[model samples]
Target: MEGFLEGIWHPLIDNEKCTNCGFCYNYCPKGVFEKNNQNIIVKNPADCVDGCHGCEWKCPGNAISFPKPITKEYVIKVIRWSKAKGRNVSKDFIKYALKNQIIQQDEVSKEMRD
Candidate 1:
């Protein structure tokens, strides 16, 4: 699942609300945010952790936001597609999705069967 979900989920910064604070840049462990001269920008959005919202939570101006919430249907679609493409879905990703309630336990098998 290394590059499977890349560029799918990422943060969007509201420039009006952003104060050019570097908190998000420093807080993001994935280097998703970077300081560009006077402003902080989303440099490598693909590197953002799927369920992690540390940058959004740490933003002092509340400028960060995701495009949409992850849904169970979406996860199932991804799983099915991955299987069709002969990609090995990561067990850790499945566990994380299950633990986070992004996909229900029973629904995984049901979706996979399709």
Candidate 2:
């Protein structure tokens, strides 16, 4: 649970496409999403918990998708956190983050608008 492992992966989101409705955030079982300035962000990307594809399946804008595979250690940490919190993470939620690439874009936009 400290290094990378094979078969581990996460979703990438497109912030431009996200409506910030919190659909992925609220639906995520592992608390993988967060809201900032009416946009969705990946607050707990390393805590995806489970590879469940619920978020990808539910996104209306198709703003979610899987990115480069992650390490098993990272995946374990994600799953461990979700279980400790009594929940399971969703793949769709991560997809929103991946498809939108929220992390870098959100920060850039936030700084510009400020």
User: How big is the positional error of residue 15 in model 2, measured in Å on the Cα after superposition?
Assistant: 2.0
Q: What lDDT score goes with residue 40 in model 2?
A: 87
Tell me the lDDT of model 2 at 78: 56
Model 2 score (lDDT): 0.62
Q: What TM-score against the true fold does each predicted structure earn?
A: 0.57, 0.51
Model number with the top lDDT = 1
> How does each model score on lDDT?
0.79, 0.62
Q: What is the lDDT of candidate 1?
A: 0.79
lDDT of 2 by residue, 1-114 (tens): 224332354567987787777889889887888887788888777776445567877888888876754444444455455556666444554444446554344543343243
Predictions: Cα RMSD each: 5.6, 15.0
Candidate 1, residue 110: Cα displacement in angstroms equals: 19
